[model samples]
Target: MNKQDRLNIDTKCINNNSLNSSQEIQEFLEGYEGYQHLFLIGFESDIGAQNCESRTGQELGPNNFRALIEQLQFPSSNSFYDVDLSSLKLAIKDCGNIKPVISDIEATHQKLESFIKQIRELSKDSIIVVIGGTDDLNYPALCGQSAYSEKLNLIRIDPSLDFEDKYRKQFDDLEPQFLEHHQSHFKMTLGNEIILEKLGEVLFYGIQGFKIDQDHLDQIQTKLGGKFQYIYFDRDIRKTMFDIQNQEQNQCKASNILMENRILKESQQIELIVNIDLTSIKAQNAPGVSEPCPAFGFNTQEIEDIAFNIGKQENLRIFTISEYNPAIEKFQTGNVLCSIYQHLLLGIGERLKNQGQVIVANEYEDIGQQELEQDYFMQQAGEHLQLQNFDFDPSLQDFK
Candidate 1:
């Protein structure tokens, strides 16, 4: 890949013959109208990863993952008629990659911020799945989300917490950091006063204790109090798995760690971003990340359950998969990531289907129309029109 090459939407992706109806995500090929639950966006810059001197080839992540997705078969809606994926009318689109200005990484993030803001404005209900160049990309991703929601709940699944207190010093310092070294999302977000103030809650799962300073973690925990909730380390997760695997009888009940959390329940009512760092997985399952500590991560099944359950939430706005290095793993990691995608899509589709609402393209259109109508009605009603003019009881306002 050319380092200074400007990013552009690869129209070749939409025209590819590999994406046939029987195989691949058919909805992606059907124009923007068919997309519902998920919209995948790619980024071609691995600048962030390179800054950390961790690895390169993250720029190739989107293309490699897309190539894999194109060959995989879509779930048969007919076979699972009971859940009725057909009725749910799920759609997923490849919105193409965010191309940055020629040789400008900050400009690239600016473009991403604009793209995310546009997507949020266009369709707040649709869930966006960002295929990132690195975890640092999460900064711009959430910046766009901040445009719409004042406060957001972040659910981050990573083996390591990316918080550098020095990076949080000044907003102007970010561009230099982005250019120089790999910046952590935690540091970047906190670095910006706007994002920090807007962060209502945070949950860190599958964290690698060895990668972070315990004092820094405790300081953040104490600062946020209830908002900084639920830290599940790799060891705790392994313990759960150990217990489940050891149980010969009544094993099914013990294996219900996916959707059984209080923090997850609260996350459903607000704007939530589910970020999965592929490095959080064991090296055996995912060797494609920029930084991989072989035996120090979650297994495939554990990651899948976490993703699936998080995907099931109704208010999930964005799902990001980051730190994937295609050149490092040589396509082996895509298989596991693909399976996780399957679980996530199925969980999301089932949730919408069970709720008896297929919220996608047309639903957004209806919302737009309703808002327009409400605006017109409000204008005609007049804001200054008093309750006494309509003979309203004064006591009614005080009832609540």
Candidate 2:
């Protein structure tokens, strides 16, 4: 199929000058040279969710996300990260939704892969933000990025392990019953040997103990070895936040510190693909998902912080959010998801601000050699402790 037939643009959300007082993100240009561009692409399908016996409203996630994003006003010139927003020269384009080939999952993935490759060809440095369908979209997104990058790092923010043992076989070779039970991550990573070879430093954050099976965890550990690491939602994440709350009087600053120390690291220069599943968020904050986590998950602020941190990575290529079900939404999940996109833009703006700047010798010399050494040591110590603490078993708790 042609590009026009495979994609559906939503005209209602694009440059509608109805609201004159404030500027919405939708007003940004479809194309602009010499600017840091952000492309918004949507995948409209829930067939993968249906196959996995999950809820079915995720097909509408992209449209709902765009609707809420249209209602949010873009950051003013003086309001962005304490820096002049105009200097960033950011451009946002809504590329519209990919017309899903409902008859076959492989066909839909091929279309998505082709679309992403085209975007990469157009602007090699542009950031791509993919919304909805299911986490299954991650497979195609990775396939597209692989065309440009050989070494890829993936960070999955999800509660469940999403490992289907049957996905180890080729998509065409899988039996009907096995195909029906496949999840995104395992199918994309463990199932495909090509992807596993290129993958580097996979991190699973916000993991819930009860949602995953012990056998899958064992297999992941055995296969990936030291490269695979995870942080539990209940044990590590919440406990760290509770500790921060007790130590720091300011809640906002505390959250910032938590994200910076735990997730964001300046030393990470490798290319990254961040996949976020809405089910990783707390049900109270994001109840609309293929599968809701009523008892454990990241809060709204925490997830937003994570999005912002992920955006700041200099080599971040693709950012995807999946499994958002608007059918059961309580009118809050859409707004929360919008905020995550907005924060990601702000973080991108911060990255742009740091690019192409000339640093003088005097400015560099201001930092004492002693202070530099201390900072390096502190970072090394923190990394060591983080890895050491990751050796715990997730099956210890029965949160499910």
Candidate 3:
């Protein structure tokens, strides 16, 4: 296998040729409007159980999982998004007009490229929400043709940065592999074409990290013009707060870490691709991740608070939650799955036109939209607006 390459993910657990309707999942995939949203999960790792290892995290198995997909469909409207995908040969049969396209192939690189191609072919405007086997999938997931990718943005919510250096030994030395790797064995993906490219296609990538990657930081800096983002959950924030407080001289480090994400958000108009990993939450609260890092994920209240902020961002192109596995050992994992689903589901609901009324604004002109320092927030959410918020409070003393 290539360095960054592995076998396509194994998804043999998916037995149905179609989705089974249920209540919970239906709510999760709630706001599809004929536009497609693909949820690719990295269930093969620490989160992906060999035989249901530790079922303490989130689980959206085929049953409720189908409901999640269905919820993404139009509210009996927005007909353009309703694509009949039975022909795609996915493990699930009835994924609504949307089918459950799993990348269970042994060739991970092949699967990744194939899935991206399939998504591009299925619909030009579809949204791919990959649940993810690992964080590495983000770049290859964008391997579809570049013009199509120009419309794509990445949004990742995890506590750690998937630094290129972190997993150097995982496969071959893959940093250089993408430039030299190509395969043509996928017969069942979207467009049925074999193509390859590295990183030119994506618009913007949004990553929320707790323990970030230096390479990722570098990319965020150089690629994003020094605006890669990371969101520390309350606990991680508190932890950083404590660490900084305990430090003798470098006291500003703690304050900088705490304010890093918002500061990045404040500086630039981030056209986004939203990728969320539940590991950003407390592992005790969410345990089914492939890798349960100590400093990731949000508290119960933090989920929606962050999602609300994300939903409020205008430049968001795609929103994905990675690391959900249901066929594991415990049941709490399933509960967390339900909770996180509900969180993103609520975010989608907020954006959906069918779920009653959407409070669309030119920009947040309300006084409440102003920063803590009393600066106003500019137009943000979905790409039409250059999301700029004028936050003048450099010091907490300003707010005090």
* TM-score for each predicted model, relative to the true structure: 0.74, 0.74, 0.48
Q: Rate the local accuracy (lDDT) of all candidates.
A: 0.65, 0.68, 0.38
Q: Write the per-residue lDDT of candidate 2 for residues 83-106, one digit (tens) a residue.
A: 444344565667667767765777
* Residue 41 in candidate 3, Cα distance off native in Å: 7.6
Q: Which ten residues in a row have the lowest lDDT in candidate 3?
A: 180-189
RMSD each, Å = 14.9, 17.5, 19.4
Pairs clashing within candidate 1: 36-91, 51-182, 52-182, 159-208
What is the per-residue lDDT of model 3 for residues 1-400, given as tens digits with 9 covering 90 to 100? Answer: 2211111111222443322233313322332223224333332322222222234233344244434434443111112332112211111112221122232223443444454454445444434444444333444454543335543334345555443221111245445221211111111111223322212122122234435455655654554452334444454566665677788544433224422454334523433555566566667776655556554445655554555445434344455555555544234554554455444434444454343333223212321232222222222332334345445342432101
Write model 1 residue lDDT over 210-282, tens digit each, in one string: 8878876877776677788545555666677667678853353211554565556555577888888888888
| Cα displacement (Å) at residue 168, model 1 | 15
As for candidate 2, its clashing pairs are none
**Candidate achieving higher TM-score, 2 or 3:** 2
By TM-score rank, best first, the candidates go: 2, 1, 3
For model 2 the local lDDT of residue 347 reads: 76
